[model samples]
Target chain A: MHFHKYEKIWLIFGSGSLIVFLMVLGFAAFWKGTHPQSHIETIDPQNIEAHEAFQAENLGLHEVEDGKYIVNIVASAFNYDLGKDENGDIVKTIRVPKGSSVLFQITTRDVVHGFQVAGTNVNMMVEPGHISRFETVLKNNGEFTIVCNEYCGIGHHLMFGTVEVY
Target chain B: MSTKQLTFSKQESTLYMVFMHVTFVSLLIGGLMGLLQTLVRSGKYTLPFNIDYYTILTVHGVILGLVLTTFFIIGFQFSLLGKTVGISKKQLRAAWLSFWVMLVGTVMAAITILIGEASVLFTFYAPLQAHPAFYFGLAFVIIGSWIAAITNFRQLYVWKKANKGQKSPLLAFMVTINMAMWVIASLGVATAVLIQFIPWSLGYAETINVLLTRTLFWYFGHPLVYFWLLPAYMAWYAIIPKIIGGKLFSDSLARLAFILLLMFSIPVGFHHQLTEPGIDPTWKFIQVVLTFMVIIPSLMTAFSIFATFEITGRRKGYRGVFGWFRKLPWKDVRFLAPFIGMLAFIPGGAGGIINASHQMNSLIHNTIWVTGHFHLTAATTVILTFFGIAYWLIPHLTGRTLTAKLNRLGILQTIIWTVGMTIMSTSMHIQGLLGGPRRSNFSEYAGGEQVATWINYQLAQAIGGSILFIGIILMVYIFIQLAFFAPRGHEEYPIAEEESDALPTPKVLENWYLWVGLTIALILFAYTIPVIDIIKHSPPGSVPFSWPIGRS
Candidate 1:
């Protein structure tokens, strides 16, 4: 019903701090295109292998418009295919050229898993029957490891993939 | 009836005794599991048994997060209620019943977890289901808590009926806000568990919409943290100032904060789902904004609390800038523990801002940074306050004076806890920035070389975590020593008086129904679209897959 003068001042100062925080987040999401990956692509897990785009050979680096490179991945119980080797073996490295907008389109065959590249702001929950996608410019040149931060099963900790930025 | 007419009876003390015993035991078990997992996770040692990592992690999280905090808060609130508005014989009976039911539920759940049929962690959403007993046991615990909350509400209702025009005492009012919030918050997880998770675990369903369950879980999850923190806030409001020889800065401000917490905490669970799909980004952004709005109350709390320190410090012949800060009783464990808890919360609140942002959430969403942030928030602030509470409460319950030796141990426990938590959380935060994932035992991340840099931090966390275990063991011993065999003396329940005010608060502040109604409505407004879309877009029924971890 009543306020101490200092209490009222504190309330105002606290509210002002909040406004500043929200404004920075708003600026980044709306203006600077720095929002978390929300909309990119989707694929049902049950039919992922049969889907033409995710078939072994079709999963590598590809130009999807002008500067965008898409890496389609089908993650299962404990592993994700970063790309294919020369003999068609599943390689652990997801190689993308530097300064390119690379989109990681990831989905799981069973259970929920997280596709998180630890060093960069590239993370999403790869779910069963739904795809999780994130597109980010591979600005820094380094080898970044991707780990399944979500607890899927017993081997959750051993689940790691790599992003090689050149 | 006024304050003196409602002194806490011995029956209520026994109830406090029962609840606090549960808290300490749970704290002990949880701390042990936590210690083991930290070491194993560091790649420094193998888990002694054939038992694996996530199982230990699940036990650690559930025991500490759910069991310890719940039992302690419920137990502590009984004393609060008894002190403010006397608990009837009937209410005491109900409280005991609630305690037994909760204990049974905890045992049932613990059995399932120990047998390794429920390795799904605390946020075990649908599709990754646990044993049927695990879900059922958890539901029982919720129901037991619901019974306790309902009994509490009844006490408040009866108090209101008798004293029609009087403002509810601050302690009673604070407890009710948390209880009401808990009751409403539990529903979301209850629905997920009852209609979906339990049935799925029992083979009653073939598929489930993971998005719906996740949405529901976080709906409960975020508020659950507030529920944990509110008791600490209560201590800060009612007791901390008294310990420092001052009164609450403003009672109305404290109530305003709790009211805002009840309203805003539920609707903003979607902030946790920012990294996941199926929720619209616009809805996420809206929820994120609400999440930021929630920050105001905590910041106000920071200012109000620090102001008390200043006022008290000024009284003690300390004057001018930062001199007041120097006047705080740093040697008294009762003051020191909670004060340090509040200090840790400053960063905790700041880290939450990053987690709740759409732009920044991506950077730390699944990283150990999130883990580090929460450890500082709930684990540090809430646990440390509870430890401080134990210092006085155990003595009160047991009718003993905490001797000089035990008090020295108490102070050492607080200092050890702070040092360990600082090292552990700081390393976790930096490693998170370097992309170390939380909840993972990453012995090899993309093979050996890439993870080489993380080993030192991992070892640092292990060392810190080990020290924390020593602190827990010491605190538990002190609690036991105080409770069972210490010399008898009259112990006081710490409660502060407020400076003279207009006697009763404005009737509008006492309008509890309106505040709770708005809370429920906001929850509906925020959740309606996303929940509806989750059901509409996804196919039905997700079958439970058994966990692969070994039995204890």
Candidate 2:
């Protein structure tokens, strides 16, 4: 076999690659060695029993400080409604005091239901035996809509819940 | 070995060249649009360009996902299939038709999206309606692809009938896997458009569920990526060996890899919908489990393919398990592309495994992390494979030797691209973990610095993206040179290189392991589908459930 002149070029490229790989490897090692992982916080969905529920009527808004609160949530295939309203209309409202922190623990009885609190910046993963925690501060007072981001079967578009902040 | 009998006809070679031209053109178009999106979003380009972000995103997705992958696979498959099944010019014409139909579909889709008609991700995330033309154009593209698949299947069946009882060629196996996945997977999207979206858009159906639409859409979406990936794997298996001057490590291992790709890639679509409403937690868990199962085959390929490189490297005068790396031809794009492309599986495989994990997926889902993950695999593993393939094919197609200068440029482009994308994607993954959403036009915090880390990562991504854009431009220039001025038939290929060896068959290939493996995989699939239906169809008042406060 004849000696190829481009052999030197190949060697240079290989060496350059090696140096780049070393730099990346060093950066990764340093990053992994320094950063701390965010720990998972928890909340429950059964503790909001017979509390004075401030109904936000619409897909109302809410603000809660960084803490945990159990939200009683019921899921049906067609629509989701909170227990009851002042005039006795079935309303979905979980009112937490302003400046208090909470994680609205939610779940469903039938098909999967989506618990999305719109406009309040607290969206989470809701599942059974898994309290989807939304950790945030109640910096302002307002209402937010808890629209389901998940499609719970055919009537998914109509699956709505409400939250009111007092 | 007669030189006269060994060469492909002019028409066959022209078809191959056309496919390469289309792929490279689509790559440049997609890459430029993607760069524009990155620049505008990163605030680097404040120019008064009226290019819509959604339009550019749509072009990028459709062009990359549909055009580049389709052209590369069809082009490569044509050549390989000739060796596998004795390809004819008539079949080549059918392949060309597929390309034209796809080209029209792409143009229509681009027009529809650019004019603010259809802003949906090519997945066409539903209840979020786009123009009727977008869906109609998409239909034409799918139909064309289906025709292409049928043509391929017909040829393979013909070959099988003629060569009764022989195992399919490894190239044939990879193409078959991709074709099978495409035919099976496209049904979901086709059904969505036919039964749900089409009627809804046409005013025939009053109301349609977005959840159901999404479920079906991702069903097609996830497997489509595999369709793109398998062709790349084909090159890795078949061509990389010859280029590296080594034999395939294990024929049976390669067959198993294809079988696993077909089996696991389809049922794991729910992983994409993990955060979406409707699917049960238990169901999501099952999807996650199956997604992880895909990793086994991927790792198997990685091991087997890398081992081939090691053996080749050793034969070329390197010592030690790692020493083989030193002997590799780093400046030969024909050699370097596949080599670097294969190593890309490191991040691609790791990211895929992370996405497949249930708890971990929640952290990265819909975040810039997801974007990073796909870029690692799609851009690096698959697209880079195409780059390598172009070099491998140029001599055969153009009948000319690719210039050494162009060869050097191709290698430089591949390296710059690999390094630039790695840094960009790695940073995106970090930002994603910090809750940076993917596909957002312009994300802003309420005040001072809530997502500072994410912001910094995006900034770094912008810098890396600029470097990547330059590399892309260099590639386009090299391809043009290869097409126009490269001397025809300058490097004569030995006719012996075209024939297969009747060597000692690997135990895996000699047996019907793939059939048995598939049968077992089907059983696992059966167990999961029922769970999916149960969770999906449960009555609203069926069972009382609540979120658990904490886990042990």
DockQ per model, Cα: 0.60, 0.06
lDDT tens digits, residues B507-529, model 2? 45434356536734753563356
What is the per-residue lDDT of model 1 for residues B282-333, given as tens digits with 9 covering 90 to 100?
A: 7888899989878878877888898899988887889888998987888888
| Cα shift from native, residue B452, model 2 (Å) | 3.8
Clashing pairs in 1: A118-B435, B207-B541, B207-B542, B208-B541, B208-B542
Model 1 clash count equals: 5
Q: Score candidate 1 by DockQ.
A: 0.60
Runs of candidate 1 exceeding 4 Å displacement? A40-43, A64-67, B1-5, B501-504, B547-552
- Interface CA RMSD, all predictions: 2.2, 12.5
- lDDT tens string, model 2, A1-166? 1112443354355445434543443354245421111112221223322223312232222333344344545444445545565676665556776666654544433333445454454544443222233444455565554555443332343455545566
